[model samples]
Target: MDFAFSEEQEMLRSQARSFVTDRFGAERVAQLAETEAGWDESSWDAMTELGWMGLSIPEEQGGAGFGFLEEAVLFEELGYGLYPGPYFSTVALARRALDGAPEQLKRLASGGSRLTLAWIEGGRAKLLPETGMSTQAQESGDGWTLTGEKHLVPDASAATDVVVVAAGPEGLGLWVARCEDAKIEMDPTMDRTRRLGRIIFDGTPAEQVAGAGDVRSTLERVQMTAYAALALEAVGAGQAAFELAADHVKTREQFGKPIGAYQAVSHQVVDSYIGIELARSLAYWAAWCVAEGDERAPMAAAAAKSFAGEAAVASCERAIQVHGGIGFTYEHPLHRYYKRAQWIDSFDGFGSVQRASVATALLGS
Candidate 1:
């Protein structure tokens, strides 16, 4: 299927790129990473004013009423910019995870609240298990009490709310809880731009949402959407790294000529460029499948995620190699991009897990 962006979508991309270039440059991102919140209030407010948080939300739910495709366009630009904020956790993960909760959806669309997901437990990152979930939810008066710890929850400290998946007497369910009510400890990670948290819940109050579908099915659907969004983000990062390397090779002199003039350097750059393009195509296709609710979305998302992640990492590595020792230094911005790509590639399901998912879809589970 053709995944060409509409004229309006292209315009959005242009606008987003301009915004990122002006407001979210590497310097700005680095500055934000040094802050306590790891983001700028003004920048986030500007994004909210632009209706980005509501881009994929339905109109009836108090959003701009755009589809996932438009959101994907914005996500790629955000990735390229290396945006440091909870936008990914709020929109890409929480919004998609809690679609059945209209009131919370409205709050998110309006930028009145920020929510993140807490699902991975005890180093289990591949899939949400049907059983043996450490977090347990017990029925309380008019609500539920969640108990246990969640590992590596993105933006937990920054979010106002958290969507926690826990096992209950009725099986697993999605529960919404106040972030303040839980013990949130930020973990030191390679990607300081995007914060991760270790969240512990001891008799924390929560309200269940998304009750129509089976819990595993709902979680799987959320994961598919996340995979597509993350793939596109990785593609953007890869593109940025490639651009940086391409520009560097053309300018940095060696033997009184540009280093890019050498076939050894030029060939590597060309290979990276080709990989980014391929990853971009697959990522966009996966986004399209998700937007259309196509039956093949699972397979498409897995394949796109698996390939895009590797492509992005390879691009970062090649960029470093081409830049020589400077790229390895902390002062250079290339390392930041590399760290961000590595973090995203491992979040939730890594490349190997995604590839296994694709294999299962193609070969028979």
Candidate 2:
């Protein structure tokens, strides 16, 4: 099938690329790595001004009136740039949940408000929540109280609203918590580019959005979005990493000849290039599924995440080796991409998770 973008989509992609390139380019990611926070709020505002922050929201609520395809196109650009921000948190993934909340969605799209969802604890969920939760309707004369702690809340530090998940007496569900009424505390995290912290709740308040039946459905969709977004990022990182490797091999000489001329290094560069293209293909297929509402999107998403994650990490490692000692240095740009690649690959699903997901899809059990 032809994967070429629609004319409007291509225009959207071109506009987003120019905007991001001009606003948050490579140097910007390096600068953010120095600071404790991930996003350049001004750049984010620029995205909002470009209507990118509202890419998937309904135009009726002051948004761009687009959906997954638009998001995927923009994400490919984000990956290419290795943008160090919470675009995934605020826009691509959580916006769907916010779409359920009219007021919050409108505020987020039009008012420069930020929204994030806290589902997995520590990082991506390899399993389920430990010491999960059970809901109780505490009888207050006026209302009730909710108490639960969600660890490793992403981009919650500066967020205007957080969508929190909890297991109630009936089943697993989620609710929205405002930082003001709900006890939220943030701190610096390993991935300084993405804001993460632990959220505390002491009779902390919430606004329920989904119940048992649809909660997991919604959550799964969000996870797919996360996988899709991060996978695209890996594609970007992988492409950059491979380029770095190839460029070094072509120029870096040893024994009076370019290292790329040697069979060993030449083969390595070739391998990296192949992996990047194959993973890119899978990722784009997943994006297409998401945009078209294909059922295969979920499994295809898992496959894409698996492939991209593996590729990003492997490509970075190989690229580092291609750069020799320089690649290991703090000053080298390779290290920046390397670290980011490592961190992002570890998100959504690790190697094994994706493998099993692929297996589950391929085998009829």
Candidate 3:
């Protein structure tokens, strides 16, 4: 089978790249990163106008009617441009939680509401709910009341609603809580481009979206998708760093000669290229698996995320090294990419967790 993106997918990629490049310039992104919201509303509005917010939703639900592949393509571009916002949290995480809620899905697809996933508890990254979840969802008369603290919730401050994963009397359940009901505190992050917050739910009323029986499946699906998306983002960031380093070495001169002419510099560039290519291949393969609902999606996603995350960090490090002192400075954009790569690498789970997932899939757990 041909392992290339279709013409339509390529077009979507091109469109997304152009939109990010034009809309989120480096200076503009930097400015937004320093703001309290950590993102520009105007840019988000522009994206909504472009129908990107609804890219993966069904056409019947007021969406663009695209599949996971299209969504991956867009995210790859967003990663390359380092577009800062809650788009990933809203579209990738919360939107998936609205699987059975048609009204919420329609509103999200129409960009009429913004929601984020508040699943991480105690600042620990976990793939399963059986891990260290302290949040509890107590059954009330007709609703549920959640009481617990969630740490490192992505874009919590910007969300109108939060989909929280909590342990109930019956087991794990997915609960939707209004942002107004929870106390949100912005957390300082290394990558200011991406916002994170701590949400405290003190007797917060919530609506149950999925129960214990179905929550695992939903969480697994969300986790796999998140891995795939993050892998693609790593690929994008790695590719960008490789290009930046390659361009810098070609122009920057040392000892009256271009640094790229030196074997040491050339070798690093080649290494970055190789790593990026490998990560890109894996990321695309995982994306295709997810889009097709293939059985190998979980394994592919784990492998892709592991390799891509490392590749991105390596590429950024090499990029900074190639640029010498200028790269480490705040004035240079290379540091921004490095910070973003580091943040993405730690998202969902680290390389160790991903490797464990791969091992578990290969060997019987």
Candidate 4:
């Protein structure tokens, strides 16, 4: 299939880039990171007002009526700016899960409610935790009661509702449960920018909508959404790191010449350039798959996430390397980009996991 983004998609990309650039420059993002909340409320509100938070929502639900490709572009801009918020967890995975939940679409689309997916368990990384969840989704007169614990729920401390992926008597349905009633507790994280919470649901109220089909089938769809958003975010962060490094190389001097003149530094900068462009291609393509409703979106998103996530991490590392001793310090912006990329890698298995997923797709189970 042809991989070019249509003019309309390009327009959307430009608009989103402009919005993020104007809203969260290096200084401003740094400023926001220092706050107790570690997220920029003003910028988050601006994104919601611009319909970015619900870009994929249908117009009937008071959204932009756009599709996934457009959303991918916006997310790349967020990554580029390192826009701190629950944009990834709240907008990407939670929204899709809620779409399958009974009567939750209206609340979610209106931004009157927000949700986070809780799948992370303790000390598990580099791959999805295989530990069986303990959540009980037993039938009730009204609906269902969810009782269990989910650790490392992004933004759950402030969410209105949470989409709990649990084993139910019938099958796996994205169970929607009230957040305030769930007895969630916040925990400190390495990033310290995005809040993490551990939630305990003691017969908490829930509404379950059986997925379009089986549990695994529904989860693939959910993962595609997450992978696509991470790809876009990678594109943003990689490009930002490259820009910062490039400017520094031109201005910083060594041996009576700008560092850009040195082959050692110039080559790394060029590599970063290539990495960003390659990652960008994969991200946009994955986004197109989602918008066009192609069945191959899962694989496409995996490819994009793997490549872009790696590229972002590598680019930030090179940025710090090129910045000399100052890059190692906490005061440098390179560290910020570096930490962001590390979080992305740790949270979503690095490109290695995607590579394995791709291999599985090609070779079959």
Candidate 5:
């Protein structure tokens, strides 16, 4: 079996890398981090022109007609560049949940609107906190109204619509609420490059996209895809950090010799490399499994997410240590990568949560 990416996938990867490297460099990311929108509108327009938002949707649906593998390739490049935008929340999370809503999907594919999933409730620090969700969707005269508070909504301020999971007459379901109706307050976080918003809905009008019977399956699919994408992104960041640290060690001298000549620095770099490579392999495997709808996809995603998240954080920390005092300064780009790794590591759920899921699958829970 061929484990390498196909020629076409390689081309896609190269193209994405070129665009991200040229347009979304460290300085550009830093500048965007200071903005209220947290992204450049012109650059986002360029990405829409490039058809990145529709990479995984079917051609019939006005997308690139590719699979999750192709999306994985693009996300990896985005992660490497640390592109400060809602691409992950919009494309990876919101788009997946909008499968049943053609009009919303069309808007997303055209980049005419930005949407984000609002599932985290009560400021809970976990993924898919369904049981703890207090959001209620009450049936009204021809529509629904949502009343509750959602915390840590990714890019909520930038989103035009929110895909919210709320309990209704039929039970738990998915609803699309217009952001204009919801009270949104942007919050400051360690990862300045990304934005998180606290959203409050008070009898907000919404459109149901999925009923109770179908909500679980849809959410599961979205969760798996999110895990795969985030894992791949983590791997990309880890690889970049490793490369940077390796280069630093090779040139920086200590005791009249390159620090890389010493066993200690070389060993740390080598360990980081090994971790990144292992994480990459798992990330790719998870993406392929999700794309192919394999039976082991859940396990694969859990394992990939668990390991890759930690590995990426470790790689960033090691890079910082290897760079010595300079790495600790805020001016260094290493801090940005480290912050991103930390953010991704904690997003959805921490490594421990994913590892527990994998353990349950293996041990027969």
Candidate 6:
């Protein structure tokens, strides 16, 4: 399949790049990362005004009716800009969790309200339902009550609603509950730009979203989507790091000569370029599979995430190395990219986990 972006997709990328450059420049992003909210509401409002909040929602649901490819285009630019916020949680995870719930979907897509997924338990990230057995849902009066603690929930404090993955008497299920019903506490995070929260749901009222049937399959699909988005986000970070390194090497003089002229620095920069290109190819392919609903999407997503995660982290490290001592300082933005790359590499599933997923898909488990 042709992985090249279409004209419209290119236009979308151009627009996103321009918007991020104008609205979420480096200084603004840095300021927001230090703020209590960790995100700019006006920037989010502008994105909503541009219809980006519902970029992937179906047309029938009051969205732009675009596919995952378009969504990937937007996320890639967002990552490049380091536009901190709940875009990943709201659009990638929460929207998919509320797939059948049109009313809630519309409200979330409208952009004022935010939603996040609470899947991790006891600070462990488990993608399979069998492993997510800590959180439990019990039948209550006219509804279900969730009683458990979820840790490392992304953007949980800013979320108006949370889709909780829990185990019940029958089987694995998904439940939606208001964030206000649970105790949300901010957690320490490696990447300060992204907020992580711990949530305790003590008999919190919830409405079942998925019950019976193969709920694990649904969870896998959600994971696949998230993996693809994260892969593209990693690719974006890699691109940014690569550019930063390349520009620095060209200008920074060592022994009265540009460092880029040195074979050692030049070779590392070339490796970063090659890594970014390879990861970008796989990420775009995975995005296409997701957009077209291809059967190999799960495997493709795994491959993309694994490779892109490694590549992005490597590229950021190379950037730091190329920049020399200044790169390690907090005053430099390259460290922020490196930290964000590490954060993205660890989210949903890490490099080893994703590679294991690919192995499972290839060989019968």
RMSD of 1: 1.4
Error of 3 at 314 (Å): 0.2
Q: How would you encode candidate 6's per-residue C-alpha lDDT over 1-365 as one tens digit per residue?
A: 46589999999999999998898887887887788888876777788888888888877777888889999998899889887888888888877777768878687668757888989886567766555468899999899999999989998877888998898888788999999999999987878777899999999999998885656777887898989998999999889999999999999998999999999999999999999999999999999998999999989988998899889999999999999999898888887788888988998667998888788878967
**Candidate 4 Cα outliers beyond 4 Å, as residue runs:** 1-3, 122-132, 211-213
The Cα error of candidate 2 at residue 330, in Å, is 1.1
> What's the TM for model 3?
0.96
lDDT of 2 by residue, 1-365 (tens): 79787999899888977876787666777787787555676766777787887777788888787888888888877877777667777776567666567777787777457777777654335323334554322323444456766666777766777776776656766677677776667776655566577777667666677666777677777777777777888888788889889999999989999999998888888888888899888888888887787999878888888888888888888898878999898777777667666666777558677678778889954
Counting only residues 3 or more apart in sequence or on different chains, how many pairs clash (N, Cα, C under 3 Å) in candidate 3? 0
Between prediction 2 and prediction 5, the one with superior TM-score is 5
- C-alpha TM-scores of all predictions: 0.97, 0.90, 0.96, 0.91, 0.97, 0.96
Inter-residue clash pairs, candidate 1: none
Candidate 4 pairs with clashing backbones: 76-232, 80-236
The number of clashing residue pairs in each candidate reads 0, 2, 0, 2, 0, 0
Write candidate 4's Cα lDDT for 75-129 as tens digits.
8877887877777878787776655543566666666776788765545421233
User: Per-residue lDDT of 263-297 in model 3, one digit per residue for the tens?
Assistant: 99989999999999999999999999988889999
Q: Mark the regions of model 3 whose C-alpha exceeds 4 Å error after superposition.
A: none
Alpha-carbon runs more than 4 Å astray in model 2: 121-145, 180-190
